[model samples]
Each structure stands twice: as C-alpha cells, then as structure tokens.
Target chain A: MAILNLKKIGVSGVNSALHKIVENSEKDFEIRNPQGQHSIACGINAPLNVEIKGHVGFYCGGMNKYAKILIHGHAGVGVGENMMSGYIHVKGDTSESAGATAHGGFLVIEGNASSRCGISMKGVDIVVGGSVGHMSGFMAQSGNLVICGDAKDALGDSIYEANIFVRGEVSELGADCIEKEVRPEHSAKISKLLKSSGINANPTDFRRYGSARQLYNFDVDNFESY
Target chain B: MSEDIPKTHPRKSATFDDYTLSEIRRAAATGIYDIRGGGAKRSVPGLDDLLFLGASLSRYPLEGYREYCGTDIVLGSRFATNPLKLKIPITIAGMSFGSLSAQAKEALGRGASIAGTSTTTGDGGMTKEEREQSEILIYQYLPSRYGMNPDDLRKADAIEIVVGQGAKPGGGGMLLGQKISDRVAEMRNLPKGIDQRSACRHPDWTGPDDLEIKIHELREISDWKKPIFIKIGGARPYYDTALSVKAGADVIVIDGMQGGTAATQEVFIENVGQPTLACIRPAVKALQELGMHRKVQLIVSGGIRNGADVAKAIALGADAVSIGTAALVALGDNNPELEDEYKKLGTTAGAFDDWHEGLDPAGISTQDPDLSKRLDPVTAGRKLSNYLKVMTMELQTIARACGKSHVLNLEPEDLVALTVEAAAIAQVPLCGTDWIPGKKNEILLS
Candidate 1:
C-alpha cells in the first residue's frame, strides 16, 4: 500500500500521483490529511482501492470508474458525482448533491445527507444509513435509493422509475412522486442493500417510493398542470 | 391574359408575409409556441452595417506580401498556470454532441485543430473523438451537468461555466426524443426516446457568490492549471461582465441574441437578450472600469459570419470571436443540394430552421445512422478548414488596409457605422461625420 499525505505533498502532487497511478497500478492508495480538498482521486479509471482519511471537500472521487473509494470522514457536495461503475463508502455525513447524476455505482453514506441528494441519479444505488434532507432524488431517472432513517420533505420529486426505500417518516412528496406498497421482492432487494451498507435494519420496515409517471407524455390537458 | 387588362390580384403584405401568417396560424392552432434551433430570423443591426476606414494618404498601409500581421492571443493569463495560446482570434463555439452528430463534432474538432484554434464541448458532454481530434478542447460546465466529470475537466485546456446562452438567456434547452440516440442517452444519463429538459440554473451554484465558490472549486479540481471562463448572455453585459470578473474568470465569453441553439422557444430566442452589435461597448466599458481590460480576455459570439465581423468585434474591444451558426453552414448544414428534402419538410434550404426535427438531409444536426453517415468528418473538416483559412485571409486583408500590424490593434477609430442604429449600438462615428451617438461633444469656440 502507498500512502500519500496531502498536507505534505499538496493537491498537485496528489493529482499527478493519481493520474500516474491510473496509468499503471493495481495497488491500494491511502490518502491522508485530505483537509477538505476538492476532486481527490477524480477520474480514476483503473481498478484500485483508494482510502481517504479525514474530511474531504466537493467532488471527492468524482467520475470514478472501476475503482473502490473509501472516505473515512465526512464528504462535501457531489461525492461520487457522475461515477460510472464503482463503490464509494462514505463513513460520515455528506453535504448536498451526494451521488448526483452517477450512472453506475454503489455509494454507501453512513451518516446524514443534505438536500438534493442523489439528484438526477441514473442507475447508481445509494444506501444512506441516516436520514436525508429535502428534495432528495429529484429528477432521478433510474437506480435504487435506500435511506435507513427518516426522509425529509419533497422526497423523490419529479422522479422517473427510480425506486426509493425509506425506513422512517417522510415529510412530504413533490410533484409526480408517489409511495407504493413494499412488495416481497423489495424486501429481498432492500435486505441485500442494507446488508451491504452495514446497517442493522429490517427490510420489511421500509416503504417504496417512485414516480407516478404522469409527466412522461405532454398532453393538451396537462398543459395547465405544467 | 389580355395585354392591357388591369388585373386585380390578391396581394399579401410583405411585412406580414406567408411565413408570418403560417406562424400565427400555427400558434393559434397548437396553443403551444414553436420550438426550433438556430438564431433569430428577424433582421437586426449587425456587423454588415460597419465599414473599416482603410489607410489612405492620411495613414500608411502595410504591404500585403512583405509585412507581417500578428493574430496570436493568450487566454487565461490572469490566474491560470497554463494559459491558452490560440493562433487565431476565431474559435468554434460550444455545440453539444447530442445537438450535433458524433461525426459533426469530430469534424469541428478537426477543423479547429487545422486552423490552430479551439473547439468547445457543449451541454451534453465531451466525446472521445472531440477530445482526441482537437488540440485545445474547452469543456463547458452547464446547468444540467450532463456527462460532466472531473476527468474531462482535467483533460480540457480550459473550462467555460455557462451562466446563460445568448439564444435563450433565462430559459432551459430541450432535446426532442427523436434525436436522443443510445450514445447521447448514455452520455446525458437520460433514457432514450424521452424529451430531455436541461435546467436553467445550476444544481450546485445559484448566484455570483456561489459562482465564486464554484470557480474556486473548479480551480482546485484542476490544480489551477486550466483557464476558467464564464459565458453569459448579452442581456446585461455591464453587470454580467463585472460580476464574472469578480467571480474569478480568466476569460469572459459574452454571447448575444443572434447566437444559435439546438432547441428553444421561438419567442424566447427572438425576444430575449441584447443584439450582438449593441453588447460589445458596454462589456468593454465594464472591463475598462474594472481596470482588467486586456488582462482578462473577452470572447464575443453571436452571428459572427465573416472576417469583417471578427475585425469589427475586435475593434469594438473583444479579444476573440466565436462562431456557431456560420460554422455549421461551413460544415454544409442546410445545403441547397438537400433543397428537395427541405421542401418536402415544408421549408426551403436557406430558410430551414427546424433543426430540432432530426431530419436534416446534410446530416450535421441529425442522429439517424444513415443521415450521419453522409457527413464524412474528413471531408467536412477540410471544408471547414478552407472556410477558416478564407476568413483569416479576409481579416488579414482588413488589418493590412487599416495600417495595423496586428488584428488586435484594430480600434473603434478605424470603423464608421453606415446607419444611425448601427452607430449608436456600436458606439462608433457615423460615416462622413465626426459624431458618435450618446457621447458628449463640445462645440469649439473659434
């Protein structure tokens, strides 16, 4: 394992190391003293294990593909944004737009997530252990979003097909978002996601939410609604 | 058919002609306004109304063959570690991959590369072909954030944060279902065959203070190597330019009302924003007042068709000019060879503006496999390079005639407006007069 101290080497050194490591490396990297640095381990296409210690800033492990990233501390906004096929484990809390627009990835946030979490998410499975703020999963197209704790207002607003599993009370639902009955298959799926996220929760306790699909097609009658 | 018979024929008003009537009827029938591509169709004051005062006995002209005229410009030298050195003052504006075919995007890259200028990736995202073909690729960070990634950001030579587009300043963009191919769908993270509406505002940042933070974030992401550009519509150039400068922009791209789009409401496109001719002086004034003129580069775009337009924009105090509609034309969009196909769609070749329909015969705007195949990137790229070369030659000729060693040295003093509207908008003197509109002149006491 190679350890890169961000405080000692700085961001440029870290980026250069990451870029070079992406070219040739199958080894693990431990980044220390992240100190709220943005875009750490960004655009890493290689299959490697990256562990960042301490709080990191926006876009941590952004656009990550074929790499496993573990943030041992709280992450800022856009953690694992636009990520394609990767596993991001955030050990602590996160700010806005967590896992935003990610296509294919497994993002596990242990703590609470702020507003707009998983906004415009496409095919990324986001499992948050704690609660999520308002407007979570807004315009979400696909994938699964599982929240262990309570969900705040406007959950899954303007959503499209993406499944949402919330264990606790939801404040409100936004336009086109509806709560559906939790089926047996949902229990099995939520069971798997919860287990992977390392949460001690029962899958049967969750409710599934999704798009009502009314806004899919534009009609003359729906013009006033728009 | 009588030789001297006075015939009564039903005549239509030229002011409200067939097209206008059709538009009114269509609006009345549909209830929803028309959505189309390209810029404003109505005639507005443009660079065509300006003429350069070429050197005569009053000034010495440079010999065309012997003398050298510089056109090189360094962008993002204000704060960026690695600034961009463009060989020409012309750049290819941001046109998304979804709006244009992959081949068309590649062709733009090839042409820009051949011309030693830069090509930009618009809303949808950056493509591999675009990244590989173009030497200097500017990545656009739009409100939608479709296909935006950190890797592409680092890969780009510069970054353009799009606050607003010239065509529709406060409005969002629409990509119809027909044009959204599987590849485009994958890039944008939206389902295929669904009408995609991009956000008018960014998801992360809202106002200028947030914009400042966003710029800081981008700089931190790129390690301050890439130049950060802020592109704004020409609605409020003075305030917009000033705000962008405060937001730590290395370059400011001001796009005017005449700028093109993939798809937007016709009303928004035609009604919103200031004309390109009227925007330059105010933007220059803002830059001068900030005492950052020439330090932070300004790129003007919107209906920049020829070298004369480029010369005029620079004279009006722009560092560079970006072209989109004209670039598409040079790439053989709306060709007369496809006039039959265009007529079948109820429009003529030169007048066709329904680019959102995805039925372009020239293949520059469509996503259909058959249509896209018609545009060979190499052939189209060569044509674009040829057009760029001609434009550069024209600019050189104008610069030589103006007795300027460099195109950047072309000032407002070298220009005279042909019309009062043009003179007022351009803030230049009218021809055969020493008067500039909106300027305080002192009557000399002899």
Candidate 2:
C-alpha cells in the first residue's frame, strides 16, 4: 500500500501523479485530495484500491476493472463508465451518466446522481441513495440500478436485461419500467448492497423495475396499429 | 383559417393523390426521383391473412385475454456481450419529420409511449417533443448524420445506425422540397426543399473492420450506457446480420420489401429488394447458425399487417416485429370520409393515390399545412392506441391457439408453407415434412 498526499497536488499534478501510480503501482493506494478534476483514475487493470478524498471530473474511474475505487466527495459527469468489473463508491452527489454502460461490477453512490445514470448497463449494479436525473437506465440490457431516493422521467425505455429498484417517488417511467414485486433474490441482494453502502437496511421499501419482458425484440401482434 | 379556401376549387379541386403526384414532380429533376418514407406504391402480399396452422392433440388454446401471452425478448445477447433489455416485443420503426409534418411525428411518439414500447427517430437530430413524449426513444445515427450530439446520445435509450430501408434498399432517404419547413431545415442543417441527399455509407468508417472501432467509439462517447442497434435493408441480410454481429451490434433490425417510407423513387419502391417473407428466414438462419438467435435478438420488419403476420414472423424466429403501413391505416389514412377527395385523385379510400407528395387528406403523410392540420394529434393517437390493442388481441388469440403462453414461442415447427418461396424462406418443410437445408444455416453463419 502506498500513500499519496494531495495537499500540494492540483488537477494537473494529480492526473500526472495518478497516471504514474497506475503505471508503477499495482496494489491498494490512497490518494489524498479534495478537489474535483476530470479523468481521475481512468483505465487501470491491476487490482488496486484507489481512495480519493475530494471531488472529481468526467469519467472518473472510467473503464476500470479489478480495482476498488472510493471517492469521498462528489463526482462529475460519466463517473465509472463502461467498467468491466470492480467496485466504486461515491459519498456525495454525482453529475450526469453515473455508472453508464458498466458490464459487471458494483457502483455505489451515496448521494444524488444526475441524468442518464446506468444507461445501457449490461451487468452492473448501480445503487444511488438520492434522486437521479432524467433518462436514467436507458436501454439497459442486464444489470441492477437501485435508487434509494426518487427516479426522474423515462426510467427504463426499450430496455432488455436490466432491473431497476427505486425507493422514492418516480417522476415518470420511460416507455417501460413497470413495478414488480421484490422477490427473495432481490431482497437478499438489496440487503447486502445496503450493508456495503453503509445505509440502514430496509429492502422492502424499494420497488423493483424490470422488463415486462414484452418488447425484448419486435413482434407484429403486439403492434396492433401495424 | 378559411374553412374552405380556393384550395378546393372545382377546376383546381384536386384529390390528395393528384397533389402528391404534382408535388413529387416538382421536387424531381430531369430523371431524378423525389424521395421519402411510408408504404407500398404497388400492391403485393401484405399482412392480411397468412393464416397459421394451429396445433391439435399436443396443443390446447388458452383463454384469450386471460391467457398470459408473454412477449418478452432479449436483445444484444451474442455480439456485444451486452444488449438492451426491452419490456415488450413491439417497437416503433424509424420515421423522420424532415419529410413529414411535425404533428405526424409527435403522434407517433405519443402512441408508442402510450403502448409501453419504443419509438425511433429518423435521420435528423433528436426532437424535444419526441424526447418528451417518447418513453423509450431510440435515436438513429444515419449516413446523412444530422444532429449527432453527445448530449442526446447520452440521453437516448439506444442508438440505431440506419444503413438502408426496405422500400428503397441500397438507397438513401430523401425529403422533397415541398415538405421542408424552416424548422425542419434548421434542425437538419440543410437548405429547405433542395432535395436532401443522405450519405450512402457512414461518415464514421469505411468497412466492417472499421465499423467495429466506430461501435466502440460510440460506446465510449456515451460512456457505454446505450444499446447500439445496426439496421439494414433486406439486401444480403444473412451476410449483413452476421457481419453486424461480428462488428458488435447489440441488436439487428432487418427491414424487408413492403416496409414503408416517407418518399422513395417509384422504381425503388417497386423493385430493388426481396419480399418480406423471403428475407426473414435468411436473417434468422444466420443468427441461429451462429447460435446468436434469441441472443442477439433479430427484429424483422416489412409487410407486417395483422396478428397473423405477427404470429408468423415470431414463428419464423424473429425476436420482434416492426410496422409502418399498418400504423398509417390505424391512424386514419384510408378513411372513407376522404372518399370525395380520392375520387378527384382517380382513387378511393382504401386505395388512396400516393405517399410521396406532402398532401395527405388524412393528415398522416403530407407536410402541407391544411392537410396536416386535418389530423388532430390527440384524436389520431387515440385511434393508434385502439389499433394497437386490436393487434395485441389478434396475437394473443394466435398464441393461445398455438398452445403457447407467449406469442414469441409460436415457432416454425408449428407452421407449414403454401409456396415454395415461402417454404424455402421460412425454412419449414414444403407444406408437409421437415426438410430444411442444414448447409443453408451454416452458409449464412460462415
């Protein structure tokens, strides 16, 4: 484990430093900075734990796998994009498109997330404790998006294999996003995620959303007008 | 607005058909044809009664409405390793407003949203009205490539790269000058009424190898949060479907002949492509051979009209089905109230003249102000919803009779073809036994 203090490092220094650490270091590391900057900890393969104390910019921990990323402050747009597998935790608010298109992994955001969070997610689990912006989880295939607070408009449009759970008011669901009962598997998963996210566990409060499995592809009979 | 302007003069009182033909002529040059989207110019076998051969001893019908007719389909299973999980199997096909009235396009969005399915955008950029009305909006990134913005991309539920359409296979989309409004022109970044020419190939890449990279780039641009669909006209669909999978498409949309368009060359509409029935089996064969069927999720469109057509398409191995012409009919296109207008055009209600010109009496196809105004979006959408219900009912009945819980389970094993073309394309035995080509599927996959 290596400790990298950010009292003296700004965006440029931190970006350069993290790039170097990513190149040279291969284990768990602590990055001490509290400011938000773009492209923090992008594309790292080796298993590592990256701890960021402050806010970050677009694409923080993007396309990363085999690593555990913990952000103490808020995050910018497109946080944890296309992640293959790993764990990411954000303590504060996140900008648009949080945990977008992640195939496999766990992305836990303790605060509100902006629009399009978990868009096209394949097999990832995105847990947002607060409200999310519009068009969240659009066209997602396989994955789980859990919003502790409310979900904005167009919740799940033309979705495939993904499942969504929102606890608070749903501004409006997209083309799809029907309410489904929380089953035992879902209860167990939510219970564990609540524990990992450091929140009080109450799995029953959340409403599950998944494909009515109606519009998986295209069918003529379903399209009456056609 | 004058309830009866000189627009309908006895001497100049033209039928909706006449206006469209003249408009098309004005939009055309010496030999060049005007273009757009919509349905058939010539009559062919449409989605009326390609009746199903229901089961007997091993099958029993379920109660129609009470029966659980599951239409669930999974997309992007094989190629992307990740696909869009849609709730229903019915989806709206792509239709652009640059070639149509704004009201017409909005109605499409509203209708699709009401039905709990997805609506697709045309070649132009994402419209705010569409975004607002559409529950699941699939944005198209076309060869012409208008309105390709990252903000909309991120917001989109999925991205469809439209290669070509069924009515005009290997041909690009066209918006005649008469239909081009100021707002439509601005949004498309092209001059109004200048005969818009779309890109023949994608601006992003040259070949299939490059297409793979472009797909990745699109994922990166959206932060990997949108399902990417590759749509192609039913020309060499077996190869196209196989290659699109290789290029990493989550879903494959294969459009066949009889698919509608706003405007296309009359020649292209009549010629240039295989029938919808012929095209579907080849595409399905490709996916099944590669073990990508049901995994990659194949959507087949063209000439789809009724519940029987829908059931037949599913039985042929399509994960889903799309419609254009049937949608128009449901929206009140062939209404008998427009009978007088049709007489003036030398046609009738069910036989309305043409779709290319911007002068539809029902206000479904044209861009003309008065013509389009005739269609009230609210009323039109309600009709569309009703129409959609009928289709669902038809399919449910078929699904029940077939002894299947879901319409999607109505497989080829339950069907037999009446024609050699139908049997060959459908891959079922020639009306009696099971004698499909094993090498045919392998060839398509290869």
Which 10 residues in a row give candidate 2 chain B its minimum summed lDDT?
Answer: B437-446
True contacts kept of each: 0.24, 0.00
Each model's TM-score for chain A is 0.95, 0.88
Q: On residues A167-220, what C-alpha lDDT tens digit does candidate 2 reach at each position?
A: 899988877468788899998888888887786647889988876655432344
Window of ten residues with lowest summed lDDT in model 1 chain B: B437-446
- Tens digit of per-residue lDDT, candidate 1, span A133-191: 99999888889999999889989987887999999899999888998988888899999
Q: Residue B228 error for model 1, in Å?
A: 2.6
Instruction: Grade the docking of candidate 1.
Output: acceptable
Model 2: CAPRI class: incorrect
For B129-219, candidate 1 gives per-residue lDDT tens digits of: 9999999999999888888876788799999999998898888778988888999988887778877878787776578976886787677
Interface DockQ per candidate: 0.34, 0.02
Candidate 1, residue A56: Cα displacement in angstroms equals 3.9
